[model samples]
Target: MISVYHYMTIAAILFAMGTYGVLTRKNAIVIFMCIELMLNSVNLTFIALSRHLNNMDGQIFVFFVMTVAAAEAAVGLALMISFFRNRESIDVEEIDLLKW
Candidate 1:
């Protein structure tokens, strides 16, 4: 059986990688993927705890979080498409059109 500490370590690593990608990537799609990675890391932690505690609450919460994340992806992608159409670029630096 896998240990809780090991699971936590894996989650931590995934979260850190996601954070780094989000901070360093310039493409909106890549940033979205990083956000999903972070969310999945949290879900992994929740699933691990739920199994360890023999409880359903954590898994249920993860389901809700996944639903929200899906909605967020749809909306965010739509916005990114709109921005790309208007600006002809998806680079984060070129997003300065929003700045006044």
Candidate 2:
């Protein structure tokens, strides 16, 4: 039977993959996606624990996390679009506009 441990394992794997992607990738979009993945993994964990504990708070927290993730994604995409337009590239290493 599937249990909270299974869900937690999946969440852990997803979080690790996201972390690796964030650390190794240079593209702004990929990094953005990795951040989303990490957020999702956390959501999974929250839901799993909520279910295991028969409590509502974790699920409610997941709702808040999702809302924040959505906002973050919208803002991140906007920033990426603006940066791409300005620099003609999305490579993180190539971005120097922020350097004073």
Per-structure clash totals for the candidates = 0, 0
**Candidate 1 segments exceeding 4 Å error:** 98-100
Candidate 2 contains a number of clashing pairs equal to 0
Each prediction's whole-model lDDT (CA): 0.94, 0.94
lDDT, candidate 2, 30-85, per-residue tens: 99899899999999999999999999999999999999999988988999889889
lDDT of 1 by residue, 12-77 (tens): 999999999999999989999999999999999999999989999999999999999999999999
lDDT of 2 at 92: 91
As a whole number from 0 to 100, the lDDT of residue 53 in candidate 1 is 93
What TM-score quantifies how close candidate 2 is to the native fold?
0.93
Top candidate on TM-score is: 1
Per-residue error (Å), model 2, residue 66 = 0.8
Task: Identify the runs in model 2 with alpha carbons over 4 angstroms from their true place.
Answer: 97-100
